[model samples]
Target: MKKTVVVGMSGGVDSAVAAATLVEQGYHVQGVTLQTWEPEDNATTSKKWQERGCCKIGLARFVAQRLSIPHQVLDIRERFRSAVVEDFIGGYSAGLTPNPCVRCNERVKFGCLMEAARDLGADYVATGHYARLLSGGTRGPHLHKGGDPRKDQSYFLYRLSRAWLPRILFPVGGLRKEDVWPKAEAIGLPADEVKESQEICFVTKG
Candidate 1:
């Protein structure tokens, strides 16, 4: 049977291309987006919503349809609040600058999401992160910098559990960020028109 992979699509060019690349490689790809934040007030106005990464569920669905894959949005707001939100707030309270992306990857993306993928009988969970997973090295598994140094995301993913490395995939990790949009467009995924996700998905700009 062909392996099944659940890809975390943020509706950005990288993730759009990641899903398409996996489909081309013969894996049964499923797309999932996490609804991690909800604005408490006017902070979540339409303009601000468009700026958050995880709020692009519409575009993610568009990419899934283009790839002919099933897509779903997982409401992980409560968990994200305790796992990442509180942690981020705590860090600031302690006068420390924390990397919430790293924490989210370790606790949410690869943590909660991987568990969900397993529940769906998927063999792996994939994302658009620009980092590569290498196996059978001198050690059991290693996460390496992506091929494109300018866009490598290894630093943000350094906190991922070593045990989960075997079941994780980053299809676009080998490509330059510059090439991701064109590839998404080539695959007819509409997310090529979506802006790149560069901000913290949960933080609202004041």
Candidate 2:
């Protein structure tokens, strides 16, 4: 059987191309979006939400629908807050520093989303994350850069394990952004050509 891949599509061009590349590679692909953190009255976060590209579910769902793949929206609000969110605030509160998205990638995205994909019959979970998984003959798993350094996401994924490395796929890892879009367009990939999202979703709530 062709391996089944569950792709975490965040409604962005990068992820849109990722899914298409996987399908082109003959893997049975499924798409998913995570609904993390609802917008509370936290003005600070809300302001940031209004800023730039944040993870947006509507955008993600739209892309999934366009791709003609089954899309599931999983609520990981509590998990994000505890694992990625609180740790973010806690880091600043303690006068130390933290990387929330990295936390999300490790604790929630790879951690929780992987299990969700398994429940959906996926043998492998994929993301549009621009990090490549490298397994040398003897070296443990390492994340390498995407062809597009501007979009490279390996820094946030350094914590992913050697165990999980083999099960993860990065369709956009080898391709540059310029290459991704033209191909996606040729394949009739569905996703906004121009998206305004750049912040985490929950930060936008009222």
Candidate 3:
């Protein structure tokens, strides 16, 4: 039986390429997008909210259809609010600068999504994060910096439990950000058509 993988696609080039690569490598791949927030939540904030990336919601479905893979949008808004957003807000009240990405990766991505993958009988849960995983050794699994130092996301991923490392896949970690474009295009993916995702996906302003 082919091993199955549930890819957390954000509708970006890197994730698009990651899913495509895993499919090319003969793994049974399914794309999942976690919808963590709503525009109405930030409606009264500012004009920056207008810049929120709609691609995150729509494009993932587009990419999945293009790649001929099953796709689903998981509504994680309540979970994200308690696990990441509220934690981030509480951190500010306590005068601590919380890294929500780290929290999301540890709590939401690997934690929640991993369980989802297991329910689907998937052997692994993959993401487009720019960090590599070294597995199949006596030392267990090790997470390493990506090939592109400039875009290395190891820091955000350090909070992930060591146990989950074995089941995690970072398919694009070995390729530089620039290299992902061509690979994405090679798969007939609309890599350049979508605008780049914002730095902070949850917050509209810095």
Candidate 4:
């Protein structure tokens, strides 16, 4: 039986290519975009959302169409806001610098979305995160640097469950940025040249 891999698609080039590569490798792939923020639809936030990329919500549909895979949008805004954003604000208020992305990886990325992936009958959840989860059910899930040291995101992913190690795939973990570009271009994604973002998606620039 083919394993069903639910990919956490962010509508970005790396994730888009990751899902494509999974398809080429013969996994039963589905794209699930976690809607982490309840957008205000105001001009300012709307402009920022446009600038940062839509997480490929609608574009995930397009990518699914292009790859002939299943796609779903899972709304995790309230959950993320409660867990990550609240912690961030509280931390900042207390004079501590909080890492929302790390909290988000623990709460939103792993906490909320992983449950959804299981509910959808997926055997595993995958993403384009640059961190690698090695050690396969040992050391409570060892999160480490990606093969591409330049883009490794392990620092933000140390809180994941060790049990989920075998089930998560970082398709772009080993590949450098230069290697990822052609895959995006070949897959016809729209954001080959878009700048990668920093800070939490909801945390606005000053």
Per residue, candidate 3 scores C-alpha lDDT tens digits across 6-81 of 9998767788899999999999998988888763434332232233542265666667888899998888889888
Local lDDT at 11 for model 2: 58
Positional deviation of residue 26's Cα in model 2 after best superposition, in angstroms: 1.3
Candidate 3 vs 4: which has more lDDT: 3
> Which number leads on lDDT?
1
Question: What ranges in model 3 sit over 4 Å off?
Answer: 39-55
How many collisions between residues are there in candidate 2?
7
- Candidate 4 wrongly placed segments (more than 4 Å): 39-49, 136-141
Compared with the true structure, what per-residue lDDT tens digits does model 1 show for residues 1-206? 99999999876778888999999999999999887876323543334425565646666776898899999988888988899989999998999998888898888877866877988999999999999987867667789999999999999999888888888999999988778878877877544246666777777689
How badly does each model clash, as a count of residue pairs? 0, 7, 0, 3
Worst 10 residues of 2 by lDDT: 45-54
Candidate closest to the true structure, highest TM-score = 1
lDDT of each: 0.82, 0.72, 0.81, 0.76
Off by over 4 Å in 1: 39-49, 190-192
Q: Tell me model 3's lDDT, rounded to 2 decimals.
A: 0.81
Worst 10 residues of 3 by lDDT: 42-51
Q: After superposition, how far is residue 28 of candidate 1 from its true place, in Å?
A: 0.5
